[model samples]
Target: MSQTDVAQANPATRDAEVLIVGGGLSGALLAAQLLRLPGRRRILVVESRSELGRGEAYSTVELGHTLNGNAARMSVDPDNPDDLTHWLTQHIAAGGWPESDRQHLPVSQLFAPRGLFGVYVQQRLAEAREQGRARGSSVTHVQGEAVDLEIDRDGARLSLADGRQLRGAVAVLATGMFPAARTPQTRSSGLNAAALDPWDVAAMAALDPQARVLIIGSGLTMVDAVVSLEQAGHRGPIEVFSRHGLLPHVRRQPPAWEDFLAADLSIRRPRQLLRALRQQCHAAQAQGIDWQAPLDTVRVHIGRLWSQATDVQRRQFVRHVRPWWESHHHRSPPLSAELVARLHGQGRLRIHAGSYQGLEPSEDGGLAIRLRYRGSQESVRLAGDALINSSGIEYDWRRVARPFPRQLLARGLVTPGPLALGISAAADGAVYDARGQASARLFALGPPLRGMWWESTAVTDVALQAKALAARLAALPL
Candidate 1:
């Protein structure tokens, strides 16, 4: 099809060489890199949210919502590992901030506020746009939700909720995590007041300060909710319910001479790697350093270890060990952890280790949570003024409620991975269809590609993927 014909076919399409969905970190970074390429191809970015950089992760209004990971290790630029630190220094210097306030620390030591990081990302995008404008290259940013994706003989087409469409030679899906799937019983009961997703800030805000709140899971999301509640001046008692009543560990300061996992450790099998990691952790602890040091080393080598694992080993890891791994690997900010501890110490927070049977409406117009404790023949019921599901994103691809994945599955444009955690994609993030044919013009990134690359969700891993994908896209002929 001709360029004019393509542009005329869709309202938002203007014959761009590349189109990116989801203007979060990955999409925004990709757009910036594409602008650096020596080409005149138009680039279009569609974001469902009004904000370009915040997405779901950094869009919180609470100032207490800090990044779990440190800033030194969270740079958008892969070439310079210290780019985020450099940016922080430059920003502080330009603003005449005190040097005492800004210290050179380990990337894992700095828990910057999530909104500040969002601002940094937005600044980078603004610079890219300015550069593109100066070079006379077309760049467009559209604010809309992409509800449908159609891949025809000519190119890719995206249909928005507003009845507008965008066509491009290539499209990248970086839509990030979908909302958590609600329990069947909860949905059937028709109670919309319960917050099934942590992103429902309005629902969380609507609760009275004196009302009791029950959080579904005890992970990072739960920490975020607790921190947000405290920041909002909530004075009510809070309860966190999970299988083990396990909360995320607090981030620790790194030791000066900590070295556990060697740089040359071979990780070809999942079990072997786990054993080695445990051994390294033990050794580090024995040396008077925290086990987190060794775990950090392992994180840097996770992609290689995951790539080496057999399908059975991968499934085993997910089934038997993924939860434990996540609790340790994804730690909470020290401040958040301290707050949780303080709440517990003061009898304001209660953590229960039990299986959530279901929820029932109480006579008092609250929620009666029925749960079964371990080794108990009898079930118990607890009442809460509000319920918040902080269970994290529902990972089962079959249960996803979004239109793009469902439509893609119906059209045979995508298939679930062997373990079905996410869509099947090649090593380079090129998505494969149900027919087992890889699409040359389509790719998947971020959490959706978790099935293929087990370590793709974290900021460090996604940032590296963004840089590599940018170079790959730049090399592609328009």
Candidate 2:
């Protein structure tokens, strides 16, 4: 069916058994799983954006923006472990790529483009709709922003920005990550045109190639913006600013299996876990394997460790080790890493490690950014024609100025987690209110719940959460 016809159907205007607020990867996966259930249960997904499958993270048009992890590790299907690998092979075949080149690379080392992954997800959703399953418990995609949610004795009422209301027996808040927070100096000085949000495609496309660009943060988002500039044919010099100025390490193919971490090893404390990981790294190196293999072993246990950690331990991890951990754990794809290397080799990309002090208007309508470097009491300055806020999602819930979450917290319907990183949620994905009561009807399953679960961003971790949430929603009394 045409997209216009689907919009005209308006099945989401009616009541539904399950109402999903976000149509990102988690929501789409959960919707697909719900359709597989035996009994009938209506599933309506309300997405603020026009596209259903491509959320902010996966919506890039640039082919250089590939998945950080390998294809073999990412799959929505828990039962079919090689689902993404099979999809990659089919995709390459359809694209007429040489089979000789495809067969040599390990499935675990293949890095697919983000857009291709989005297309794969859309295809899966389409296949689910083709079967008779979607007809009974239909998956309706609505294009509207959910502004307010009213939870009362008679289920939940969702208020959209366009004055429409959606009633559902159960509502899931899978609203992914919060948008990057803007600095006050940029806002008050009328420098909005100079400072761009990385996700704002329209603004990015309007940038002039001659203009000098300054990216705010030096992480995955910065890598994405740099890649987007190159893909868009921009040739201007780019400067990346961050507290540590540390770029993501490149991901490489893993070597033969090494015995470092036992499958059943359970270390909850941050200090103890770090010590054990360091020891494992040395052991793996002596056995002719890189330390990263053992770290990958630790990644499998991160969720369990986070759940068992005390508040003090969690704070210790965040305060003392999160920066180093993030840079190493979230490695860049080989293509992106090569691009950065080339840019640095050509002297077009400059990275600065410092804390942003402020920004001032230059004489020629450009921006002069002030920053304080490490071990320096004095401030330094850099001039740029345009600046991009490529910092990843702001985890502080209190800093989020959006109306939906602000209203929810004001009404005691939601509460921030122990460290105020994001919304509090139980281990089963059920959201906890201010009274510390888990609402069986409301659940959050994504990076927004990072305060409660530290390892919730990657595709594999989120897929597991989606599966667990799908089971819970399926078992709900309707």
Can you tell me which runs of candidate 1 are displaced by over 4 Å?
A: 1-14, 94-108, 134-136, 179-193, 196-206, 256-265
| Residue clash pairs of candidate 2 | none
Error (Å) of candidate 1 at residue 350 is 2.0
lDDT against the true structure, each candidate: 0.74, 0.76
RMSD of each: 4.0, 5.7
RMSD (Cα, Å) of candidate 2?
A: 5.7
TM-score of each: 0.89, 0.90
Q: After superposition, how far is residue 177 of candidate 2 from its true place, in Å?
A: 1.7
Positional deviation of residue 169's Cα in model 2 after best superposition, in angstroms: 0.8
Best by lDDT: 2
Sliding window of 10 residues with minimal summed lDDT for model 1: 183-192
Error of 1 at 353 (Å): 1.8
TM-score of candidate 2 to 2 decimals? 0.90
Candidate 1 residue pairs in clash (backbone atoms < 3 Å): 72-107
